[model samples]
Target chain A: MQEELIRKHRWFWAWADDREEAWLREMAQQGLHLGKAAPLGEYFFVRGEPRDDVYRLDYVPMSKKDEHYYQLFKDAGWEHVGEMMGWQYWRKLATDSQADEIFTDNDSKIQKYQRLLAILTIFLPVLIINVTNMGVFSLREKYPWIIGLQVFSIFLLVFYSVVLLRILFRIRMLRRR
Target chain B: MAGSDVRKYLPLTESTYYILVALSEPMHGYGVMQKVEKLSEGTVTIGPGTLYGAFGTLEKAGLIRMVKEEERRKSYLLTARGRAVLKEQITRLAIMNRNGQGLLGILD
Candidate 1:
Protein backbone atom coordinates (compact mmCIF):
# COMPACT_ATOMS: atom_id res chain seq x y z
CA MET A 1 0.00 0.00 0.00
CA GLN A 2 1.19 3.52 -0.78
CA GLU A 3 0.26 6.83 0.86
CA GLU A 4 -1.08 9.50 -1.47
CA LEU A 5 -1.19 13.02 -0.08
CA ILE A 6 -3.35 15.66 -1.76
CA ARG A 7 -4.08 19.29 -1.00
CA LYS A 8 -7.68 20.39 -1.27
CA HIS A 9 -8.96 23.94 -1.27
CA ARG A 10 -12.13 24.97 0.50
CA TRP A 11 -13.23 28.24 2.07
CA PHE A 12 -15.38 27.89 5.15
CA TRP A 13 -16.55 30.84 7.21
CA ALA A 14 -16.89 30.55 10.95
CA TRP A 15 -20.68 30.25 10.79
CA ALA A 16 -20.52 27.59 8.05
CA ASP A 17 -18.62 24.97 9.99
CA ASP A 18 -21.27 22.44 9.08
CA ARG A 19 -20.41 22.96 5.44
CA GLU A 20 -16.76 22.14 6.12
CA GLU A 21 -17.77 19.07 8.08
CA ALA A 22 -19.95 17.88 5.21
CA TRP A 23 -17.13 18.40 2.72
CA LEU A 24 -14.74 16.39 4.83
CA ARG A 25 -17.24 13.56 5.18
CA GLU A 26 -17.74 13.61 1.41
CA MET A 27 -13.97 13.30 0.90
CA ALA A 28 -13.88 10.35 3.28
CA GLN A 29 -16.61 8.66 1.32
CA GLN A 30 -14.43 8.98 -1.78
CA GLY A 31 -11.46 7.30 -0.05
CA LEU A 32 -9.61 10.51 0.83
CA HIS A 33 -9.13 11.04 4.56
CA LEU A 34 -8.03 14.33 6.04
CA GLY A 35 -4.53 14.11 7.52
CA LYS A 36 -3.67 17.70 8.42
CA ALA A 37 -5.37 21.02 7.97
CA ALA A 38 -3.26 24.12 7.45
CA PRO A 39 -3.97 27.80 7.80
CA LEU A 40 -5.65 29.68 4.90
CA GLY A 41 -8.14 27.15 3.56
CA GLU A 42 -5.81 24.27 2.69
CA TYR A 43 -6.51 20.66 3.70
CA PHE A 44 -4.14 17.70 3.42
CA PHE A 45 -5.66 14.32 2.74
CA VAL A 46 -4.39 10.76 2.58
CA ARG A 47 -5.81 8.27 0.12
CA GLY A 48 -7.39 5.13 1.55
CA GLU A 49 -10.20 2.66 0.96
CA PRO A 50 -13.66 4.18 1.02
CA ARG A 51 -15.29 4.00 4.42
CA ASP A 52 -18.18 5.52 6.26
CA ASP A 53 -16.85 8.08 8.73
CA VAL A 54 -18.50 10.98 10.46
CA TYR A 55 -16.50 14.21 10.57
CA ARG A 56 -17.19 16.97 13.04
CA LEU A 57 -15.57 20.27 13.91
CA ASP A 58 -15.68 22.00 17.25
CA TYR A 59 -14.54 25.58 17.77
CA VAL A 60 -12.29 25.15 20.81
CA PRO A 61 -10.17 28.26 21.00
CA MET A 62 -8.27 27.40 24.15
CA SER A 63 -8.20 23.64 23.67
CA LYS A 64 -4.58 23.66 22.59
CA LYS A 65 -3.59 24.20 26.22
CA ASP A 66 -6.38 22.08 27.64
CA GLU A 67 -5.44 18.41 27.62
CA HIS A 68 -8.51 17.37 29.53
CA TYR A 69 -10.74 18.90 26.83
CA TYR A 70 -9.32 16.66 24.10
CA GLN A 71 -9.27 13.66 26.43
CA LEU A 72 -13.00 13.98 27.04
CA PHE A 73 -13.69 13.75 23.31
CA LYS A 74 -11.29 10.85 22.98
CA ASP A 75 -12.97 8.93 25.77
CA ALA A 76 -16.31 9.57 24.10
CA GLY A 77 -15.05 7.62 21.02
CA TRP A 78 -13.99 10.53 18.78
CA GLU A 79 -10.61 10.34 17.14
CA HIS A 80 -8.75 13.66 17.32
CA VAL A 81 -7.42 14.10 13.85
CA GLY A 82 -5.81 17.56 14.02
CA GLU A 83 -6.28 21.19 14.94
CA MET A 84 -6.15 24.17 12.61
CA MET A 85 -6.62 27.72 13.81
CA GLY A 86 -8.53 26.92 16.99
CA TRP A 87 -10.85 24.40 15.31
CA GLN A 88 -10.55 20.77 16.44
CA TYR A 89 -11.11 18.04 13.90
CA TRP A 90 -12.72 14.86 15.15
CA ARG A 91 -14.00 11.75 13.40
CA LYS A 92 -15.87 8.65 14.42
CA LEU A 93 -17.05 5.60 12.51
CA ALA A 94 -20.54 6.02 11.07
CA THR A 95 -22.62 3.68 13.14
CA ASP A 96 -26.13 2.39 12.65
CA SER A 97 -27.71 3.28 15.96
CA GLN A 98 -26.72 6.70 17.20
CA ALA A 99 -26.65 9.92 15.21
CA ASP A 100 -23.32 11.73 14.93
CA GLU A 101 -23.83 15.13 16.51
CA ILE A 102 -21.42 16.93 18.73
CA PHE A 103 -24.18 18.95 20.33
CA THR A 104 -27.17 17.09 21.74
CA ASP A 105 -29.33 20.15 22.44
CA ASN A 106 -30.06 23.58 21.03
CA ASP A 107 -28.61 25.51 23.95
CA SER A 108 -25.19 24.01 23.47
CA LYS A 109 -25.43 24.46 19.73
CA ILE A 110 -26.18 28.16 20.24
CA GLN A 111 -23.23 28.43 22.58
CA LYS A 112 -20.92 27.06 19.88
CA TYR A 113 -22.04 29.71 17.40
CA GLN A 114 -21.84 32.40 20.07
CA ARG A 115 -18.21 31.55 20.63
CA LEU A 116 -17.54 31.96 16.93
CA LEU A 117 -19.36 35.28 16.93
CA ALA A 118 -17.30 36.44 19.89
CA ILE A 119 -14.09 35.88 17.96
CA LEU A 120 -15.39 37.86 15.02
CA THR A 121 -16.60 40.62 17.30
CA ILE A 122 -13.11 41.03 18.68
CA PHE A 123 -11.50 41.56 15.25
CA LEU A 124 -14.31 43.77 13.95
CA PRO A 125 -13.34 46.80 15.97
CA VAL A 126 -9.72 46.46 14.97
CA LEU A 127 -10.64 46.40 11.31
CA ILE A 128 -12.82 49.43 11.79
CA ILE A 129 -9.93 51.28 13.38
CA ASN A 130 -7.71 50.46 10.43
CA VAL A 131 -10.23 51.73 7.94
CA THR A 132 -10.81 54.92 9.92
CA ASN A 133 -7.08 55.59 10.30
CA MET A 134 -6.55 55.35 6.59
CA GLY A 135 -9.41 57.70 5.84
CA VAL A 136 -8.76 60.28 8.58
CA PHE A 137 -4.97 60.36 8.77
CA SER A 138 -4.51 60.59 4.98
CA LEU A 139 -1.98 57.76 5.29
CA ARG A 140 -2.83 56.53 1.82
CA GLU A 141 -1.31 59.70 0.32
CA LYS A 142 1.80 59.56 2.54
CA TYR A 143 2.45 55.85 2.15
CA PRO A 144 1.58 53.99 -1.05
CA TRP A 145 1.42 50.73 0.91
CA ILE A 146 -1.40 52.19 3.05
CA ILE A 147 -3.73 52.02 0.01
CA GLY A 148 -3.28 48.27 -0.29
CA LEU A 149 -3.67 47.82 3.48
CA GLN A 150 -6.85 49.89 3.50
CA VAL A 151 -8.39 47.85 0.71
CA PHE A 152 -7.49 44.60 2.49
CA SER A 153 -8.98 45.84 5.77
CA ILE A 154 -12.20 46.83 3.99
CA PHE A 155 -12.51 43.35 2.48
CA LEU A 156 -11.87 41.70 5.84
CA LEU A 157 -14.41 43.95 7.56
CA VAL A 158 -17.12 42.95 5.09
CA PHE A 159 -16.25 39.30 5.41
CA TYR A 160 -16.24 39.40 9.20
CA SER A 161 -19.53 41.31 9.26
CA VAL A 162 -21.20 38.72 7.07
CA VAL A 163 -19.91 35.89 9.21
CA LEU A 164 -21.02 37.66 12.36
CA LEU A 165 -24.53 38.15 11.00
CA ARG A 166 -24.79 34.53 9.92
CA ILE A 167 -23.69 33.31 13.34
CA LEU A 168 -26.21 35.57 15.04
CA PHE A 169 -28.92 34.22 12.75
CA ARG A 170 -27.92 30.69 13.65
CA ILE A 171 -28.18 31.47 17.35
CA ARG A 172 -31.61 33.00 16.86
CA MET A 173 -32.76 30.01 14.82
CA LEU A 174 -31.50 27.61 17.51
CA ARG A 175 -33.33 29.55 20.19
CA ARG A 176 -36.58 29.38 18.23
CA ARG A 177 -36.24 25.61 18.09
CA MET B 1 -28.19 31.38 48.62
CA ALA B 2 -31.77 32.35 49.12
CA GLY B 3 -34.52 30.04 47.81
CA SER B 4 -35.69 32.71 45.39
CA ASP B 5 -32.14 33.21 44.10
CA VAL B 6 -31.65 29.49 43.57
CA ARG B 7 -34.95 29.34 41.73
CA LYS B 8 -33.38 31.34 38.92
CA TYR B 9 -31.58 28.26 37.67
CA LEU B 10 -34.58 26.01 38.03
CA PRO B 11 -36.24 24.03 35.28
CA LEU B 12 -32.88 22.71 34.25
CA THR B 13 -32.90 21.46 30.72
CA GLU B 14 -32.84 17.70 30.31
CA SER B 15 -29.14 17.72 29.54
CA THR B 16 -28.26 20.07 32.38
CA TYR B 17 -30.40 18.19 34.89
CA TYR B 18 -28.80 14.88 34.04
CA ILE B 19 -25.34 16.45 34.21
CA LEU B 20 -25.98 17.98 37.62
CA VAL B 21 -27.45 14.75 38.95
CA ALA B 22 -24.51 12.77 37.65
CA LEU B 23 -22.08 15.18 39.28
CA SER B 24 -23.72 14.58 42.67
CA GLU B 25 -20.83 12.23 42.95
CA PRO B 26 -17.39 13.29 41.79
CA MET B 27 -16.88 12.42 38.11
CA HIS B 28 -15.04 13.69 35.08
CA GLY B 29 -16.53 14.78 31.76
CA TYR B 30 -16.71 11.37 30.12
CA GLY B 31 -17.97 9.81 33.33
CA VAL B 32 -20.84 12.29 33.45
CA MET B 33 -21.78 11.41 29.87
CA GLN B 34 -21.87 7.68 30.61
CA LYS B 35 -23.76 8.07 33.88
CA VAL B 36 -26.33 10.38 32.25
CA GLU B 37 -26.97 7.90 29.45
CA LYS B 38 -27.38 5.06 31.91
CA LEU B 39 -29.60 7.06 34.24
CA SER B 40 -31.85 8.13 31.37
CA GLU B 41 -31.85 4.60 29.92
CA GLY B 42 -30.41 5.84 26.64
CA THR B 43 -33.13 8.45 26.30
CA VAL B 44 -30.70 11.32 26.76
CA THR B 45 -27.13 11.52 25.55
CA ILE B 46 -24.81 14.49 26.11
CA GLY B 47 -22.26 14.80 23.40
CA PRO B 48 -18.73 16.00 24.04
CA GLY B 49 -19.35 19.52 22.73
CA THR B 50 -22.41 20.01 24.88
CA LEU B 51 -20.75 18.47 27.90
CA TYR B 52 -17.68 20.63 27.60
CA GLY B 53 -19.64 23.83 27.15
CA ALA B 54 -21.96 22.97 30.05
CA PHE B 55 -19.00 22.33 32.34
CA GLY B 56 -17.67 25.81 31.67
CA THR B 57 -21.04 27.49 32.21
CA LEU B 58 -21.91 25.49 35.33
CA GLU B 59 -18.53 26.07 36.88
CA LYS B 60 -18.71 29.77 36.17
CA ALA B 61 -22.12 29.93 37.81
CA GLY B 62 -20.71 28.34 41.00
CA LEU B 63 -22.76 25.20 40.44
CA ILE B 64 -19.78 22.89 39.95
CA ARG B 65 -16.12 22.78 40.84
CA MET B 66 -13.10 20.76 39.89
CA VAL B 67 -12.02 18.36 42.62
CA LYS B 68 -8.83 16.87 41.22
CA GLU B 69 -7.08 15.68 38.10
CA GLU B 70 -6.26 12.07 37.39
CA GLU B 71 -4.15 11.46 34.33
CA ARG B 72 -5.42 14.53 32.32
CA ARG B 73 -9.08 13.99 33.22
CA LYS B 74 -10.44 16.45 35.77
CA SER B 75 -13.06 15.33 38.24
CA TYR B 76 -15.91 17.67 39.14
CA LEU B 77 -18.67 17.69 41.74
CA LEU B 78 -21.49 19.99 42.64
CA THR B 79 -20.92 22.83 45.06
CA ALA B 80 -23.23 23.97 47.87
CA ARG B 81 -24.81 26.44 45.51
CA GLY B 82 -25.28 23.70 42.96
CA ARG B 83 -27.04 21.51 45.50
CA ALA B 84 -29.35 24.36 46.43
CA VAL B 85 -30.24 25.03 42.79
CA LEU B 86 -30.73 21.35 42.05
CA LYS B 87 -32.98 20.93 45.04
CA GLU B 88 -35.13 23.84 43.96
CA GLN B 89 -35.41 22.47 40.45
CA ILE B 90 -36.45 19.07 41.74
CA THR B 91 -39.18 20.67 43.82
CA ARG B 92 -40.46 22.52 40.81
CA LEU B 93 -40.35 19.42 38.64
CA ALA B 94 -42.21 17.40 41.29
CA ILE B 95 -45.03 19.91 41.35
CA MET B 96 -45.20 19.95 37.54
CA ASN B 97 -45.26 16.16 37.38
CA ARG B 98 -48.02 15.90 39.96
CA ASN B 99 -50.20 18.40 38.11
CA GLY B 100 -49.67 16.63 34.80
CA GLN B 101 -50.57 13.24 36.27
CA GLY B 102 -53.70 14.67 37.87
CA LEU B 103 -54.82 16.18 34.56
CA LEU B 104 -54.10 12.89 32.78
CA GLY B 105 -56.30 11.00 35.27
CA ILE B 106 -59.15 13.48 34.64
CA LEU B 107 -58.80 12.88 30.89
CA ASP B 108 -58.84 9.11 31.40
Candidate 2:
Protein backbone atom coordinates (compact mmCIF):
# COMPACT_ATOMS: atom_id res chain seq x y z
CA MET A 1 0.00 0.00 0.00
CA GLN A 2 1.25 3.53 -0.76
CA GLU A 3 1.76 5.76 2.22
CA GLU A 4 -0.83 8.50 2.37
CA LEU A 5 1.00 10.66 4.86
CA ILE A 6 4.62 11.42 5.75
CA ARG A 7 6.27 13.27 8.58
CA LYS A 8 9.27 15.53 7.95
CA HIS A 9 11.35 17.22 10.56
CA ARG A 10 13.05 20.54 9.90
CA TRP A 11 14.13 23.49 11.96
CA PHE A 12 14.06 27.12 10.95
CA TRP A 13 15.02 30.12 12.97
CA ALA A 14 12.75 33.15 13.17
CA TRP A 15 14.91 35.05 10.70
CA ALA A 16 14.85 32.28 8.08
CA ASP A 17 11.11 32.36 7.37
CA ASP A 18 11.70 32.81 3.66
CA ARG A 19 13.83 29.68 3.52
CA GLU A 20 11.08 27.73 5.25
CA GLU A 21 8.49 29.03 2.78
CA ALA A 22 10.63 27.94 -0.15
CA TRP A 23 11.06 24.48 1.33
CA LEU A 24 7.30 24.12 1.73
CA ARG A 25 6.75 25.10 -1.90
CA GLU A 26 9.29 22.53 -3.03
CA MET A 27 7.50 19.85 -1.05
CA ALA A 28 4.24 20.77 -2.72
CA GLN A 29 5.82 20.42 -6.13
CA GLN A 30 7.03 16.94 -5.17
CA GLY A 31 3.47 15.70 -4.51
CA LEU A 32 3.66 16.35 -0.75
CA HIS A 33 1.50 19.07 0.67
CA LEU A 34 1.76 20.33 4.22
CA GLY A 35 -1.25 19.17 6.22
CA LYS A 36 -0.23 19.96 9.75
CA ALA A 37 2.57 21.61 11.72
CA ALA A 38 3.76 20.67 15.21
CA PRO A 39 6.11 22.46 17.52
CA LEU A 40 9.80 21.69 17.90
CA GLY A 41 10.24 21.28 14.11
CA GLU A 42 7.67 18.69 13.16
CA TYR A 43 5.70 18.93 9.92
CA PHE A 44 3.25 16.37 8.58
CA PHE A 45 2.55 16.20 4.87
CA VAL A 46 -0.14 14.51 2.81
CA ARG A 47 0.70 12.89 -0.48
CA GLY A 48 -1.14 14.59 -3.31
CA GLU A 49 -0.89 15.51 -6.95
CA PRO A 50 2.05 17.73 -7.88
CA ARG A 51 1.31 21.43 -7.58
CA ASP A 52 3.09 24.72 -8.08
CA ASP A 53 1.58 26.45 -5.10
CA VAL A 54 3.25 29.31 -3.22
CA TYR A 55 3.59 29.35 0.53
CA ARG A 56 3.96 32.39 2.73
CA LEU A 57 4.58 32.68 6.46
CA ASP A 58 3.37 35.61 8.55
CA TYR A 59 3.95 36.21 12.23
CA VAL A 60 1.21 37.82 14.30
CA PRO A 61 0.57 37.90 18.01
CA MET A 62 -2.46 36.09 19.37
CA SER A 63 -5.43 38.41 19.34
CA LYS A 64 -8.95 38.24 20.66
CA LYS A 65 -10.52 38.69 17.23
CA ASP A 66 -8.53 36.20 15.18
CA GLU A 67 -11.58 35.01 13.26
CA HIS A 68 -11.79 38.35 11.53
CA TYR A 69 -8.14 38.08 10.65
CA TYR A 70 -8.62 34.65 9.14
CA GLN A 71 -11.69 35.73 7.20
CA LEU A 72 -9.83 38.67 5.69
CA PHE A 73 -7.08 36.41 4.42
CA LYS A 74 -9.55 33.91 3.07
CA ASP A 75 -11.31 36.61 1.14
CA ALA A 76 -8.00 37.84 -0.18
CA GLY A 77 -7.38 34.40 -1.75
CA TRP A 78 -4.96 32.99 0.84
CA GLU A 79 -5.68 29.64 2.41
CA HIS A 80 -4.63 29.58 6.03
CA VAL A 81 -3.18 26.11 6.31
CA GLY A 82 -1.87 26.07 9.88
CA GLU A 83 -0.62 28.31 12.64
CA MET A 84 2.15 27.58 15.13
CA MET A 85 3.08 29.97 17.93
CA GLY A 86 1.55 32.97 16.18
CA TRP A 87 3.18 32.15 12.82
CA GLN A 88 0.52 31.81 10.13
CA TYR A 89 1.11 29.44 7.21
CA TRP A 90 -0.68 30.62 4.08
CA ARG A 91 -0.85 28.87 0.73
CA LYS A 92 -2.25 29.96 -2.61
CA LEU A 93 -2.15 28.64 -6.14
CA ALA A 94 0.38 30.47 -8.22
CA THR A 95 -1.15 33.04 -10.55
CA ASP A 96 0.64 35.20 -13.05
CA SER A 97 -1.08 38.45 -12.17
CA GLN A 98 -0.46 38.60 -8.42
CA ALA A 99 2.67 38.90 -6.34
CA ASP A 100 3.38 36.21 -3.75
CA GLU A 101 3.10 38.35 -0.66
CA ILE A 102 0.66 39.01 2.14
CA PHE A 103 2.16 42.38 2.93
CA THR A 104 1.77 45.00 0.24
CA ASP A 105 3.51 47.89 1.94
CA ASN A 106 6.91 48.11 3.58
CA ASP A 107 5.63 49.33 6.94
CA SER A 108 3.48 46.27 7.52
CA LYS A 109 6.28 44.01 6.34
CA ILE A 110 8.59 45.71 8.84
CA GLN A 111 5.92 45.42 11.50
CA LYS A 112 6.03 41.65 11.12
CA TYR A 113 9.69 41.59 12.12
CA GLN A 114 9.05 44.12 14.86
CA ARG A 115 6.47 41.77 16.36
CA LEU A 116 8.91 38.86 16.21
CA LEU A 117 11.62 41.00 17.78
CA ALA A 118 9.28 41.90 20.62
CA ILE A 119 8.59 38.25 21.42
CA LEU A 120 12.29 37.35 21.35
CA THR A 121 13.28 40.28 23.57
CA ILE A 122 10.72 39.36 26.23
CA PHE A 123 13.09 36.57 27.26
CA LEU A 124 15.93 39.05 27.81
CA PRO A 125 15.04 39.88 31.41
CA VAL A 126 14.57 36.24 32.39
CA LEU A 127 17.89 35.25 30.85
CA ILE A 128 19.65 38.09 32.65
CA ILE A 129 18.14 37.18 36.00
CA ASN A 130 19.04 33.51 35.68
CA VAL A 131 22.67 34.24 34.78
CA THR A 132 23.21 36.74 37.57
CA ASN A 133 21.70 34.59 40.31
CA MET A 134 23.57 31.49 39.20
CA GLY A 135 26.84 32.84 40.72
CA VAL A 136 28.46 29.93 38.96
CA PHE A 137 31.91 31.55 38.82
CA SER A 138 32.42 31.43 42.56
CA LEU A 139 30.55 28.13 42.99
CA ARG A 140 32.59 26.39 40.31
CA GLU A 141 35.28 25.50 42.83
CA LYS A 142 32.74 23.96 45.22
CA TYR A 143 30.76 22.10 42.55
CA PRO A 144 32.23 20.98 39.22
CA TRP A 145 28.79 20.41 37.68
CA ILE A 146 28.07 24.13 37.88
CA ILE A 147 30.66 24.67 35.13
CA GLY A 148 28.57 22.68 32.66
CA LEU A 149 25.44 24.60 33.65
CA GLN A 150 27.23 27.90 33.22
CA VAL A 151 28.43 26.84 29.76
CA PHE A 152 24.88 26.00 28.70
CA SER A 153 23.70 29.39 29.96
CA ILE A 154 26.35 31.15 27.89
CA PHE A 155 25.35 29.14 24.83
CA LEU A 156 21.71 30.17 25.20
CA LEU A 157 22.72 33.79 25.61
CA VAL A 158 24.76 33.67 22.42
CA PHE A 159 21.93 32.05 20.47
CA TYR A 160 19.45 34.69 21.67
CA SER A 161 21.82 37.50 20.70
CA VAL A 162 22.27 36.19 17.17
CA VAL A 163 18.52 35.82 16.65
CA LEU A 164 17.93 39.35 17.89
CA LEU A 165 20.60 40.79 15.60
CA ARG A 166 19.21 39.03 12.55
CA ILE A 167 15.68 40.25 13.11
CA LEU A 168 16.93 43.81 13.54
CA PHE A 169 18.98 43.47 10.37
CA ARG A 170 15.88 42.34 8.47
CA ILE A 171 13.92 45.35 9.67
CA ARG A 172 16.70 47.68 8.58
CA MET A 173 16.93 46.02 5.17
CA LEU A 174 13.19 46.43 4.65
CA ARG A 175 13.32 50.10 5.63
CA ARG A 176 16.17 50.83 3.24
CA ARG A 177 14.31 49.52 0.21
CA MET B 1 -9.91 68.24 11.96
CA ALA B 2 -7.76 70.46 14.07
CA GLY B 3 -4.61 71.95 12.60
CA SER B 4 -2.36 69.64 14.65
CA ASP B 5 -4.45 66.57 13.84
CA VAL B 6 -4.47 67.34 10.11
CA ARG B 7 -0.72 67.80 10.08
CA LYS B 8 -0.15 64.45 11.77
CA TYR B 9 -1.85 62.51 8.94
CA LEU B 10 -1.38 64.91 6.03
CA PRO B 11 1.39 63.14 4.14
CA LEU B 12 -0.31 59.77 3.85
CA THR B 13 1.57 56.93 2.23
CA GLU B 14 0.21 55.43 -0.99
CA SER B 15 -1.51 52.48 0.65
CA THR B 16 -2.87 54.50 3.53
CA TYR B 17 -4.24 57.10 1.18
CA TYR B 18 -6.07 54.55 -0.89
CA ILE B 19 -7.38 52.78 2.20
CA LEU B 20 -8.76 55.97 3.67
CA VAL B 21 -10.49 56.77 0.40
CA ALA B 22 -12.01 53.34 0.27
CA LEU B 23 -13.40 53.65 3.78
CA SER B 24 -15.64 56.45 2.55
CA GLU B 25 -18.25 53.70 2.46
CA PRO B 26 -18.82 51.00 5.07
CA MET B 27 -16.89 47.96 3.94
CA HIS B 28 -14.92 45.10 5.35
CA GLY B 29 -11.16 44.81 5.12
CA TYR B 30 -11.24 42.64 2.01
CA GLY B 31 -13.72 44.93 0.36
CA VAL B 32 -11.41 47.83 1.01
CA MET B 33 -8.57 45.88 -0.58
CA GLN B 34 -10.54 45.24 -3.76
CA LYS B 35 -11.78 48.80 -3.95
CA VAL B 36 -8.26 50.12 -3.54
CA GLU B 37 -7.08 48.09 -6.50
CA LYS B 38 -9.94 49.29 -8.65
CA LEU B 39 -9.58 52.93 -7.59
CA SER B 40 -5.88 52.89 -8.30
CA GLU B 41 -6.47 51.19 -11.66
CA GLY B 42 -4.53 48.09 -10.64
CA THR B 43 -1.56 50.12 -9.56
CA VAL B 44 -1.91 49.25 -5.85
CA THR B 45 -2.72 45.93 -4.21
CA ILE B 46 -3.30 45.62 -0.48
CA GLY B 47 -2.47 42.23 0.87
CA PRO B 48 -4.44 40.88 3.81
CA GLY B 49 -1.59 41.33 6.27
CA THR B 50 -1.26 45.00 5.40
CA LEU B 51 -5.01 45.57 5.41
CA TYR B 52 -5.43 43.90 8.77
CA GLY B 53 -2.74 45.96 10.39
CA ALA B 54 -4.07 49.14 8.81
CA PHE B 55 -7.50 48.44 10.30
CA GLY B 56 -6.03 48.34 13.78
CA THR B 57 -4.03 51.49 13.31
CA LEU B 58 -6.85 53.45 11.72
CA GLU B 59 -9.35 52.36 14.33
CA LYS B 60 -6.99 53.29 17.12
CA ALA B 61 -6.39 56.71 15.59
CA GLY B 62 -10.17 57.31 15.47
CA LEU B 63 -9.96 57.76 11.73
CA ILE B 64 -12.19 54.75 11.03
CA ARG B 65 -14.80 52.93 13.07
CA MET B 66 -16.64 49.67 12.80
CA VAL B 67 -20.17 50.27 11.60
CA LYS B 68 -21.34 46.70 11.42
CA GLU B 69 -20.21 43.14 11.82
CA GLU B 70 -21.54 40.33 9.71
CA GLU B 71 -20.43 36.92 10.85
CA ARG B 72 -16.66 37.19 11.22
CA ARG B 73 -16.30 40.17 8.96
CA LYS B 74 -16.34 43.72 10.32
CA SER B 75 -17.32 46.62 8.11
CA TYR B 76 -15.86 50.04 8.79
CA LEU B 77 -16.63 53.55 7.69
CA LEU B 78 -14.59 56.71 7.75
CA THR B 79 -15.00 58.87 10.82
CA ALA B 80 -15.39 62.59 10.44
CA ARG B 81 -11.74 63.05 11.22
CA GLY B 82 -10.76 60.52 8.57
CA ARG B 83 -12.78 62.31 5.91
CA ALA B 84 -11.14 65.62 6.87
CA VAL B 85 -7.72 64.08 6.67
CA LEU B 86 -8.47 62.59 3.27
CA LYS B 87 -9.66 65.96 2.05
CA GLU B 88 -6.44 67.56 3.19
CA GLN B 89 -4.42 64.86 1.47
CA ILE B 90 -6.21 65.32 -1.85
CA THR B 91 -5.65 69.07 -1.70
CA ARG B 92 -1.96 68.52 -1.01
CA LEU B 93 -1.69 66.08 -3.90
CA ALA B 94 -3.43 68.46 -6.25
CA ILE B 95 -1.00 71.24 -5.42
CA MET B 96 1.99 68.96 -5.89
CA ASN B 97 0.61 67.71 -9.18
CA ARG B 98 0.06 71.23 -10.45
CA ASN B 99 3.60 72.26 -9.55
CA GLY B 100 5.06 69.33 -11.56
CA GLN B 101 2.57 69.69 -14.42
CA GLY B 102 4.90 70.88 -17.16
CA LEU B 103 8.21 69.52 -15.80
CA LEU B 104 8.22 66.01 -17.32
CA GLY B 105 10.91 67.01 -19.82
CA ILE B 106 13.27 67.78 -16.89
CA LEU B 107 13.46 64.11 -16.00
CA ASP B 108 16.10 61.95 -17.68
- Provide chain B TM-scores across all predictions: 0.91, 0.93
Worst 10-residue lDDT window, candidate 2 chain B: B1-10
Clashing pairs in 1: none
Docking class of 1: medium
Model 1 spans with C-alpha error above 4 angstroms: A96-99, A137-149, B105-108
lDDT at position B58, candidate 2: 92
State in Å the error of residue B33, model 1.
0.7
TM-score of 1: 0.91
Q: Write the per-residue lDDT of candidate 2 for residues B46-107, one digit (tens) a residue.
A: 98999999999999999999999998999999999999899999988998998898687787
In order, the Cα lDDT scores of the candidates are: 0.86, 0.88
Best by DockQ: 2
TM-score of chain A of each: 0.89, 0.91
Candidate 2: clashing pairs of residues: none
lDDT of 2: 0.88
Q: Which candidate number would show the highest lDDT if scored against the true structure?
A: 2
